[model samples]
Target: MTHFIRVLEFSNKEDALKNFCGSFRSGESDFGIFSVDASTFGSLPSSVFAYWMNPSVGDAFSRFRNFAERGLKAQVGCSTKDDFRFLRLWWELREPSDKWIDLAKGGRYSPFYSDIHLQINWKDNAAELEAAILKKYPYLGDSANWVLHRESDYLKPGITWTRRTKSDFSPRFLPAGCVFSEKGLSAFIDGGSRKDISAALAILSSKPCRSLIEVQLAAADKSQAGGVANSYEVGIIKSTPAPDTDAEVTERLAELACRAWKQKLTLDGIQESSHAFHLPAALRDRLGSFDPPAIEAELARIQAEIDAIAFDLYGFSEEDRAPAQASHAAARTDDEETDADDEGEDEENAALIDQTAGLLSWAVGVAFGHFDWRLATGERAAPPEPAPFDPLPAKSPGMLPDGAAPFHANAGILVDDQGHPHDLARLIEEVLARVEAPVPEDVRRWLQKDFFPFHLQRYSKSRRKAPIYWPLSTTSGSYTLWVYYPSLTSQTLYTAINDFVEPKLKEVGADVTALRNKAAARTRDDEKQFEALQAFELELIELRDTLLKLAPTYKPNHDDGVQISAAPLWPLFRHKPWQKVLKDTWAKLEKGDYDWAHLAMNYWPERVREKCKTDKSLAIAHGLEHLYVEPEAAPKKTRGRKKGE
Candidate 1:
């Protein structure tokens, strides 16, 4: 005895189960079975009589009851014994479609108010059962309708039987060994409409149809059990045949070859290769004698046009230029010519003047020393008391003896009208008469040395020689008089002398009067100018003191090479150019030119005096050494031609 299982189709689980139970109650089955597998009633085995039900039918009943309880006004059946059996059959019946299976898997579907199940029995007459099913339900009788049968029935040989209903049932009509095996005890209830089931069975049994049909059953039992009567129709479909495997592979390989050719064509520089290998016949016919070099020349021409446009936008033009190139060429030419002339003249003149001034300075220094000695000791030595002399008077007509010439006098000095000397005190009285400042001793000495000695020398030189003859006057008998003839005519000499002397006298007298007026005015302007200079001197002293204080801390050797005294003071006053700066700053003072006076005063410390020794410009400007000092001898350098040849 082999144990087996089989699938059965039913209109619904409840209808199928009910039909099975009805057959058993009618004494139409001989299989000994006492229990059924179901969910509505408890599980049972042989000898324990019980009804089975599907769990889905029970769940549907509960849902119906719950909806009713929630005031939905839906119909819910009573749970009596009959109702319980009915639910069990419905649960056992096959569902019209497997769509219920989708519902069981938690997918959405049309609400299934019923459930179905398949029935299994140990042994039964399958042919008899089919006949009995048609007799009980006449819709199963059509040849076009499907009938459930065990596969083993057709496999048996030498057995033939005609189908019949339970009403015509006879023992002679029964097929021998028709009992359902456990493997063949399956049945199908109609799950489609009567008409659709008939058509479906017709199609299934046709020679061209590949599908197999089972059975069709009504859901009328479900309607009585408070379930929907309609059944879900379904078909198990098989797909059409596929192409041969080798043909598919060949097609794919062909496609792959075409794709590879396309990929090769997409590579850079492949066009030239493509043109060489795959030229069309028409293109080859038309391209005779065509030169690619000519095409390249045309492309080069187009590129040149673009380059020209770019150059025009950015490059320089002839108009946009500087004069530097032309000017530099001209300058070079001029420099050559100038340099040729300058070489001879410049060096000689520069050297000759420098040497002559140096010799004169040396002579003047010796003269100053001798004069200083004579002043210190009042002696007549071989030097013959070389006294310091004033500058020459321009009014003087003749030269003095070599020993007595004034220190600054030369033919050049005598020619200048402004260089005439007056009385020293009178000159001062004239110039500063309007000023209340006391005459400084150094200034008086400077004036006397610059002027008085020249005047005396001129007078002495003029009176030296006279006429030896005497002229007798009518009033006296033979009176002898020495006569002096002046260098100029009497009228000229008188006029020149008066002109030289009168203005100076007038200047002195007028200055005294102006002084009285100025004193009367008593403006604080003079005092302020004095005070300003004093303050400026104080500031300079403070600055110098500050530099000295900083000097010890600053090591010029180790630090930046700057000496404090070398720092210029002119910029501190914030004036114009240095010349105007000096003029404006010292103009308010009573001194004729305070700037020069101030410069002279500070002109020489030891270092500066030493520097003045080499600094010709400073020596000339400030009367350093030679300019201020008297010469020991007149310059012996001859100005006149030597003698008659």
Candidate 2:
């Protein structure tokens, strides 16, 4: 009987070509069919498990060193165990902080280059963070959840990848001076080795590594939920075969990878959220061509070179490379479908939209005094262009110093109503006029309707969604008041009510009354006008009442963060998804799920104060350490004389 099974999926049962320990035929699919025998497993290094698939594939493994056996070993990054208390977007902090260090959390599909926007509370090498985590987890070293590990490798240059991903196994070259998160796994080369970092990155991020990792994920991953996603965990990576880094091929791959990384960062020069961000690529004042297509073309060329050289280093001939190449081709198609980095932009006129929206958002930031307006008109020198591996900047290049912003929204309030002095549309226009850029014809409508959703998408990372510019609007969104998050206080909502909503309601009321009391029998147009005015009047009244109802007790604390602070006003958020997120967060806050939040102390002082006695972290978080009472040591009892020993 001829017996042949698929090496990956095991579908072929007819053709038995080879029967040795390491024998297989490339199937029509991207995997191979192999004749399996029980004796073949004895020749492999890994457990008689799924990672090797079948013996023919395992033979490939036996010939090479896996990551576990190589100089570089996959290392799991730290888990905050409580992200909200320990992690924050870099821009959220107002100034350069020694307390917050660069954190490499998994971002989008970009490879070779890195995108690290998060900063962790690694103050004093995370002394307080570990203490806080230990207070909660208690079984820190013994259990699954750990806050800190491998402290010696914290800031060393290594490679990183998303532990959980819907896309294929993609990795990036992480430079020195950053701590990686659990979801963002790291694999560092042993510092004593002669292995080059850039060369290793090129090899590991190539098509061969991606396909091999995909095979492992297909067999072992269930944490990716039911989707086409997978968890690229430590065990799987440590068991994968490592390609031989031939010295000549290694040098070429290193050069190309570094070039690719640099070009990729250059495209991000306009990206406000990236470490490489300096000036908008669309800015006319910049001296170079910032063509997206050109940048993309160069990156593709560089990647092609990297992949070809990587295949050579792996000792693959044309036929041997075929399946991996096919697999990678399919992975690219899948990545395009799930690319959230570009906001699902698939040849969807993305660049034009990005330029328009990013410029407008930056303008809004300038109005809030978050960014320096002087740079838009060349009044101040623009910061020098950033390189691929510059130390993370203290602040984004053109940001105004912390307190130097003069035209920040008055009382932390800006209204959307036309003719209002603090109208957001006017503020945007003033900003653009300085740069001599033409304002969009529908700019006001865009701010009211499109801007918040886009801003929410832009600022969100690692499951933390907090848009700094919040729009507390009426039911129909005809009127919105933008509240600058940094300047927000408990009284800011009161300002929105007394200064903006109340005056608008008064005008709406007068218009409604004037229309109803018209002497002439109302024309059709007048009737329509009367109806709108009446609806507006009622809506304005309802919006005002809701704010007044909450004002007496709605004390906001910024340490609770923009999301939690705005959560109390969830009903006022016109964006339904944002409203729902805030709504759920509010529920969590009320239910003690967010007890670490300072707002919890503000709302439920007794409960938090009581917990302060038990959970020292919560005590420290609330600045209520004085309330903490350490549990008394158990009575020594003198060991009861051990029954006369």
Candidate 3:
């Protein structure tokens, strides 16, 4: 380590290594250079040309007792460079399943399994994306392949993670039929056998592996520009300490991981946003009872088992596992205290609290014709089963065909009125009636007070608060019209007015007139009823007028996605945090910041039209390709035959 050697590009690395080792043996350099192949690269990626080699990188590699990076095929995935043009949320596209592959662009921390929300334009082996890259840089010539680095590895089973290690070193298992991203770096072992994969997943998701990876990223960070790394790429991971897992230990770890994965599905299956979601876990078999704490505890128990086996495989002493053990114990204690607080209520009431809520949520989904009624009603023979990495379904099993749901509102508009056939409560009751689950006594009150917030929380995942069922309520929350997000239209408010509000208002008006005509004979109870009906009449009239005023400008476009589409109706959402978010979004929309939205074009046609002429993205978003006016060239001078005449 006395002197350093820096050389120009060599024709052969092997020959260079031979000459370098010979120089040290011949005493030309004081330092002894024994082996100079992968050892020289240290923890640095062999593919990356890093000359800022630190001595500690080499020291980290020496600490790995039995593992080598060569056993795994770790590589970076494709980068579209312009994601907006090529990517869409799976639901955003029509007939998405045939042309689009699930895109694993690493997201929030979800270990073992997570929903892959994005789909790439992989219609013709990424032809569209490749053509775009080539057009952007024509000089790239035949090497445009750099844009899709190691693309041949697409749709292969691997362990994937965000190349930038955040506070949590969460790595998820990526099964076949996905194209990874640069951010979603992946590694696969030879053959990718199920047993080997299970073992790898077990190790990578363990606490010990998480600690090691973080330390490696910290070391790698020092070599980056300004001593901060934007990414924890392949090299840092390859250099992290790994166990030479024994066969028996491998099987045990895989068993625990497999159990943990299924438990995770049970947890996520209740979630409205997860791909694994089918029926809520508690209601999947029957809508009776389930202990949420117990399910969580079982999953935690499995995770602990995985960590224990992984720690032993890594040859860690009792001291090394103590901190993690203590952490798990503390978590368990906290969970026990929380569980004990749940008073011993009867099973039926317990079911009413959340188990029934889940069933009702599913029932509402059925009423809206979004979820499968058969699954909730037990008319369907079997529950939907899902693999960890199956292609996200365009229409999942148990979901009813588009026109088949009996309770689906004709115009996708359901009202709070008790009189209407398409009343939200009436349709939801229809679904609940088909199933044997305990229904809340007053469905209308639940829909008015609890349902939207419950549905909003269920559907809101990551940055998207996309509740498919939206409640557009009156100022006093006296009336509500539920609009299905997928079916919002310029005619929706008109449908609400023509179908529900006017009829209810007319009935209330007749009652008020009758009460006044019999004024002298009216009882004290009759007077109170008349006054209440009068106030209700006023609220209904205001709601109707507001819709009439807003209808001229309101345009609902699903392509704007749920949030932007819901922004214009911000005043309707009650004091929930989502209302504020929608309000801010609306403010931005009015300011011409979101002119790309179809709603924006409807709201401010002239402003969006002008933007469409200059910005192709806006034009594309609005489906107004004609608005992208190409600049006309200047006319050339004739000069009278070049003055020779």
The candidate scoring highest on lDDT is: 2
What is the C-alpha lDDT profile of model 1 across 298-413, one tens digit per residue?
A: 43443233223322222213321122122212222322121210111111111122322222222221122111112112221222211011111111111122355333322111
TM-score versus the correct structure, for each prediction: 0.12, 0.78, 0.70
lDDT of 2: 0.71
Error of 3 at 244 (Å): 5.3
- Residue 27 shift from truth in candidate 1, angstroms: 99
Query: Which of the predicted structures, 1 or 2, would earn the higher lDDT when compared with the native?
Result: 2
Error (Å) of candidate 1 at residue 29 is 99
Ranking by lDDT: 2, 3, 1
RMSD of each: 65.4, 5.9, 11.5
- Higher-ranked by lDDT: 2 or 3: 2
lDDT of 3 by residue, 371-399 (tens): 77676665655445656555556665545
Judge candidate 2 at residue 377 and give its lDDT. 68
Model 1 residue 97 lDDT score: 24
Better of 1 and 3 by lDDT: 3
Error of 3 at 264 (Å): 1.6
